[model samples]
Target: MPRIGVLIDNNTLDDHLAREHGLSLVILLDSGDRWLWDTGQSGIFFDNARAMGIDLAQLSGLALSHGHYDHTGGLDRLWRETDFTGPIYGHPAVMTGRYACSCCSPPRAIGLRTVNRQRLASQLIPVSDTARLGPGLTMVTNITRQAGNFEPIQGFYLDPLGRTTDTIPDDTALVLETGYGPVLILGCCHSGLENTCDHIAVNLGINRFHALIGGLHLKSAKPNHIEETLQTITRFGFSEVYAGHCTGTHAISSLSDALPGKIHPMGSGLLLTFPPSGHSTT
Candidate 1:
């Protein structure tokens, strides 16, 4: 059996667990290798991991989903708290400057924050294209925008001056093939879910996805927008969507109404297990 522990997220299943406006998953494979997918906006993820009985020190590796501060903020804690010396996988543009701008306001820095740049750079493994991490596990990046991916990744800039739009080329996802079926894991999902799924289908030749686990970046979207996203995602055959973090309550409600028994809200301290039978949450 494979296990996925929600180290931290926008909410916590219990009051004892810490909550944050970010996402992090502790992936434990059947082969006994432990992998970390993203690291919330602070060291709180580390504390939550310990509370959830996860051993981060023996991690096989760490894969970043994007360059956002919410995704990479806990990285400094990784170097300071754990003895983990494994390679960090992400796009080469993960270190590039990123900013968030608004009407009549300055662009705020929202990229990766670190304590030791040299050490982090030394352990970085940039993924310009799709790559397999282990048996039945793959990291996908550089999503194609064709096939009517209208979900806009707006309000972001490549520089503080907002001269150029930041398309977030570093946005990536992970695909894991389990005994039950394929699971697609995301972080923020700035590339748009439809585009990411389309890219996977075209490049990997894997048409349908069984599960979708992570943020949809639809926290502030209107009801109609969430409905449209759900309509497009159904094409991928996802039975369960563990939406969390940036996926707002309104979106969850819309998902529940649209998919009935298929919607699952993610929070810190929640554990998702995949046995030969299927997937379950606890």
Candidate 2:
């Protein structure tokens, strides 16, 4: 069996923990393989981990979803506050600068900050394509847009001046091979969940997934976009999707209403067990 712990998210599973507009997850396999997914927007992940009795330092390795602040903000804290000195995994573009420019507000740097870029560069192990981490775990990247803009991206730039568009090529996911099927975990599927699913199916030869977890990045999605996502999940037979963080309120309501108990909220303090206790929304 395997379990996934929610270290940071936009909401808390209960009143005892805190909430933030970010995301982090800890993956614990029965084989003693522990992996930290993301770091959230601050050192809050550390406090939450301590409260939940999880040791972030005692992990095999770290895999990043992308270069966003919300996903990698705690890197500096992890460097200064913990004994974690393992390898950091992600696409090479994950360290590139990212910004947002829209409406009247000036373009703002939204990529990883507070952490020393040079220090991270020294530790980052680029996973440009799917890399097998263990017997049943794989780091998935190089996501392509086979579907027609399943999630439209805008207002994001690679440079501070907002001249070049940032397609978030570094966005990645983790795949866990299981008896039932493969499980897809994401950091913020910027390439679009539909695209990510399609990539795995076409490239990795995985069709049906046992479960789906992580942020969908649909905070500001339109109704049709949500419907498209619903169809995507149905198309892939993803029975349980623990979505949170950037998944947003409107999208959550729509997804939950459409899928009933199949759609569950993921946040801090939540522990989802699998391989028999697969759908325990605890």
Candidate 3:
């Protein structure tokens, strides 16, 4: 069996826990393998983890989904606090400068901090292709763009001046082979969920996904874009979906209306358990 715990998120299960505009997940496998996926925008992850009684030093590995500051900001704190010496998996571009400029706000640095990059230099494992973490877990890198309708956010740039377009190629997902099917653990889904699913189907021969947990990065999407994304998600037929972080309230509501009980609102302190093969819930 495998269990997932929401260590940090934009919302909290209760008022006592602190909330943040970021995401982080802790995965515990039946074999005692523990993996930390992404670290939230600040030390809030550690705060929430302490409240939840999760020990950061027990992590067997660390994985970053993209270069966004919201995803990798806690790296400095993690390094300073935890004694875990495991490899940190991510794309090479994750440490590069990234910015976001919208009509509403000025260009802001949204990439990983240099200090954290230096701290994680020795343990960083840049994966250009699919990298196997364990027997049933794999890190997907450089997801190909297969869905033409899905577009990256318009205001992102690779340069501080917001001149060079940032495709966010480093956005990745972790796939876990479960008894039911493949479960996708995403950071922000900047490459588009449809594209990520297609890449997995084509490269890994996985057609159905049992569950999808993490941000979709659709907070500022247009109505048509949201509709198209929802339609594509419906076509894939995921059994369970816990979406939050960059997934706006409107989109989450729409998904809940469309999928009924299949959709769940993800937040800090939430936990999900999946039993091993042939193990009944009863």
lDDT digits (tens) for residues 87-176 of candidate 2: 889999988888999888998999887648888888889998888765577888999876566654678998878899998899898888
TM-score list, all predictions: 0.94, 0.94, 0.94
Deviation (Å) of 178 in candidate 3:
2.1
The reply for model 3, stretches above 4 Å from the true place, is 277-282
Native RMSD of candidate 3 (Å): 3.1
Candidate 3 overall Cα lDDT vs. reference? Answer: 0.83
- Looking at model 3, the pairs that clash are none
Candidate 1 per-residue lDDT, tens place, 1-282, comes to: 777889999988979999988889988887787899988999799999998889899998999999889999999898889856899999999889889998978779999888777787999999988877755678998888764464556889998988899988889999887766788999988887878888888888877878888998887776666766797668888888899988888878888888988888689998988864233210
In order, candidate lDDTs are 0.84, 0.84, 0.83
lDDT of 1 at 220: 76
Best of the two (2, 3) by lDDT: 2
Candidate 3, poorest ten consecutive residues by summed lDDT: 273-282
Q: In candidate 1, where is summed lDDT lowest over 10 consecutive residues?
A: 273-282
